[model samples]
Target: MPPANGAWAWLAPGNSWGWSNAGLISDGEESLLVDTLYDLELTDEMLAKMRDAEPLANNIDTLVNTHANGDHCHGNELVCGAEIIASSASAAEMAELPPEAMAAIVAMAPDMGEMGRYFLDCFGQFKFEGITFTPPTKTFEGELHLQVGDKPVELIEVGPAHTRGDILVHSPKDRVVYTGDILFIEGTPIIWEGPVNNWTEACRRIEAMDVDHIVPGHGPITDKHGVAAVRQYLEFVHEQARQRYDAGMSAFDAAKDIELAEYSAWSDPERIAVNVDSLYREFRGEQAASDVFELFARMAALAGYDVATP
Candidate 1:
């Protein structure tokens, strides 16, 4: 359901692993897309829906990718000629993953071959096959004041949280924020880049905004309270993991013992392993950097019930 203002359209994919919700901001003459869908087919669907609403072929003048994740920017090539914008860190992260790597992942499972079948099962049908990468032309580090029609949309950077350079889009006129991946409503929050405190602070900033409705990067369109829920969830996980880390418990060991009593309702509780791992690493050493695969495998092991194998 799109917001009542008709200024932004919310596209909810209605899946656990797919990049759940995307928003489109309209400007009457020309519009701006907040984030593209996860894959080409999904992107095409989103474009079609938007076109139906406005009946304008080229209303989308610019595409602003909130982060570097494939779910938000992979369908860039399908937009014809919309100028893409993102943070410099997001652009850097985008460059790190090749289109071929994504294609290889897409080629697996439910689609065609067997190599990606397992991944497809685990992550759902998130295939970015044959999607061309379009780099961001405008990269800004801090806050950006964008004019979407008469309203001023604030592109605030809250990085080292969800990704290298995470962003939350704020609409001052409507008192609504299109929080890109920063707040995952009713789902497990993935922390590709995090210090825990950064996320907590990001929540604090949103709380201060006192916005009416927050369009999360994934999941449903919720109010300010929903954003608070994710923040509290992160805070609870951080403290729980920190306590076990202080006791000299390993990541896998801590993963089992930690009870997510507050966030038991959200999807993918297994993600607690990764959240604990990231917090444990940060608690161990803020400046310490571990291999991404090592962290992923450890989280996977925890998710696979190896933690309770003992």
Candidate 2:
């Protein structure tokens, strides 16, 4: 959906995994892209469509990755000659799990039991092989302001929440915000890195913004109402998980026991496992990151699938 005044949001249909949304902000011959697709083929397809819709897309001057997530930035190699920019934390985190590692994990899935099946179910659609992992060429910590022709764009860092570094690409002039994974809309948000409070605070910041169009990292384009729903979910989960933590319940047990109510209807409800675990770690003041495979195994268990210990 193209918002008024040269702002366009490329939304991928369905709230399922790996189908992320991207955006293009153009004025005159200058353009800035917000994130990319999951793989080369998907990115290529998106770029083609974008070019057809807006001529400025033919030569993107800048590319801003909202976070370190593979779905948001994995197809970066396709945007040749564009100066890639991201938060310093995001850039550092990008190297932690490259395309080769992801491809290798998916390849081993057949013999790995239920967790393997679950992993494949989420990411098997994308081709991760042969992708040259592209890191950001320009990195910043606090905030960076740029001009896309005459439109003023602001990159606001709000992270250590979704990931080590997450950002919102806000076009103040056009009243549109490209929220990385911070706003999941119809999909349940998975907190891979969080204090819960930080994520909630990020939501509040978005709600307080004057923006009219909210372009989420996943799901359809939305508005402040969508922002409120996401914030409500975060607060609900945080309170629920805190109670379970105080009761000495294991994160996995708490994830299965808690009632999601309305949020259960959201796509990928199994993500609550990771969210609860992250909250528990926060409560304990633990700074160490959990093992990704172990977390997936826990999520698989919560989803009623047999999980083999990794």
Per-residue CA lDDT of model 1 for 172-270, tens digit only, reads: 777778878888888889777797788878888888995777788888888778878888888888878878888999876798788777576777677
Regions of candidate 2 where Cα sits further than 4 Å from its true position: 308-310
**Candidate 1 lowest-lDDT run of ten:** 301-310
lDDT per residue for candidate 2 within 100-168, as digits (tens), equals 999999999988888889999988989999999999999999899999999999999999889989999
Count clashing residue pairs per candidate. 3, 0
lDDT of each: 0.74, 0.92
Which parts of model 1 are misplaced by more than 4 Å?
106-118, 286-310
For model 2, what is the C-alpha lDDT against the true structure? 0.92
Measured over all alpha carbons after superposition, the RMSD of each candidate to the real structure, in angstroms, is 3.1, 1.0
